[model samples]
Target: MKKTKTRLAAIAAVALSAVLACGVLAGCASDKGEQKASEQPEQTAAASLEGKSLNIYCGAGMTKPFQEIADAFKAQTGCEMNITFANAAQIQTQINTTQEGDFFIAGSADELKPVSDYVATSTDLVKHIPVLVVPADNPKGIQTVSDLVKCDTLLLGDPESTPIGKIAVKAMTDAGVMEQVKQSGSITTSTTAPQIAEALAKGEGDAAIVWKENAGKDGLTILENSGMEGYVKTVPSAELTCAADADAVKAFSEFLQSETAKNIWTKFGYELV
Candidate 1:
């Protein structure tokens, strides 16, 4: 009976040990399962954009602000950006031909009209104003569109390809001195407003009608703003139909409206729209 009781006690001990071991294993499994469940969504999100990149076709004038914005976006979202800068017309043409770009930023709304079919949505990002830019010392006494007639070399954007040039022509025409200015000043033209600004800074031309932001460069000063006709332009941004990742594209679009982007734009002499 002693042996029987001893054997019975041993059996009970074995049973209890087995039960404890099972419980411990189950507890460990439960903890591991909970950890995996929490990590799954994070892993999936990280995987989604692990190798993804976005393409943006932007206007040359917006390079400064957009580049800063792009850096901030990549740090926050872990997505990469490829940006192409050119005149609005050239970018629009590329959008039409390639059908591969993700976003388009035009210096003016008119630049978006021709490629309306490719643009899925648009928002006014900022206001652009065209101004007469001259060397730091207001040589030649240029103060208004009328005064452009006295410049030895007058630089402007290519009206056929750039918004600034088109607006410059209108302002000159409205000022009723388009013909006189052309005849008096040696007319020089560039493909983009920013280029014209550079030319004016280098003294390549005595005067250049460029965007107000461009005129903010160190060695340049605004002689006069081509009053409100061509000067009061809005910079518009659009998401094209060819966007591969709509969520990523939309996120960037929203970022453009964010306070961070607004600060950068303002720093670059752009007013939010």
Candidate 2:
């Protein structure tokens, strides 16, 4: 009876070891299969692009719709999109200095001038107008473009590197208040419209000139006055002449001109151009 019991225990141990070995082998196979599956998208994307990738330098404000459009493009074509959003002027500067990038989306056509040599062509997509945004209480009594000269702390986009800033500077210059505002030591500068909006919301400045779409932020008020007229800036997407694959860039540009992309821009409150 003792010998019989010992033999039965030894057989049970062997059976358990075999089961554990099978489980380990199955797990290894499962992991390898998953890794291959995860690599499929990238493999497919590379094939779709014919091994070429697109690089985009986009304006900060256009990020929302551009992202939506990029995702749609990726899903349809399996091509990869590398997008970087920043001040449009800054983007142009980088593109010019590096002589790289496949496309440039500027806040305005004026911003694209710096990279004209690298841009084969471009299309105007939307319009964004400048507006004076103030705290809800209307502090400093700022009611018009003329009032900007009176604010103790007035914020605007960096005119040298921002499209809105250029427009704001031009408008203030036209109003003959640019010199006064600058001399008054009241002018503050930001890189983008969203930054200007944030400064207004934080009460960091008495007022800021920002895009109309950004005027609706809480704790801020859009000063509606005719003085803000003629400040319209248009958004344009340029196809770069330096692109490694012109066909791919052209296809993406065509997508931007589609009704689908137009709807995406409209959904973000941009006026279709």
Question: Which 10 residues in a row give candidate 2 its minimum summed lDDT?
Answer: 44-53
Q: Could you report the Cα RMSD, in angstroms, for every candidate shown?
A: 7.3, 11.3
**What lDDT score belongs to each candidate, Candidate 1 first?**
0.84, 0.84
lDDT of 1: 0.84
Report the Cα lDDT for residue 266, model 2. Answer: 85
> How much does candidate 1 score in TM-score?
0.80
Candidate 1 regions off by >4 Å? 1-48, 224-230
- In candidate 1, what residue range of length 10 has the lowest lDDT sum? 222-231
In model 1, the Cα lDDT at residue 239 comes to 88
For model 2, residues 226-258, the per-residue Cα lDDT tens digits are 388788878888888888887688678877988
Clashing pairs in 1: none
Q: Model 1, range 224-260, lDDT digits (tens) per residue? A: 4435344598888888999999778877887788888
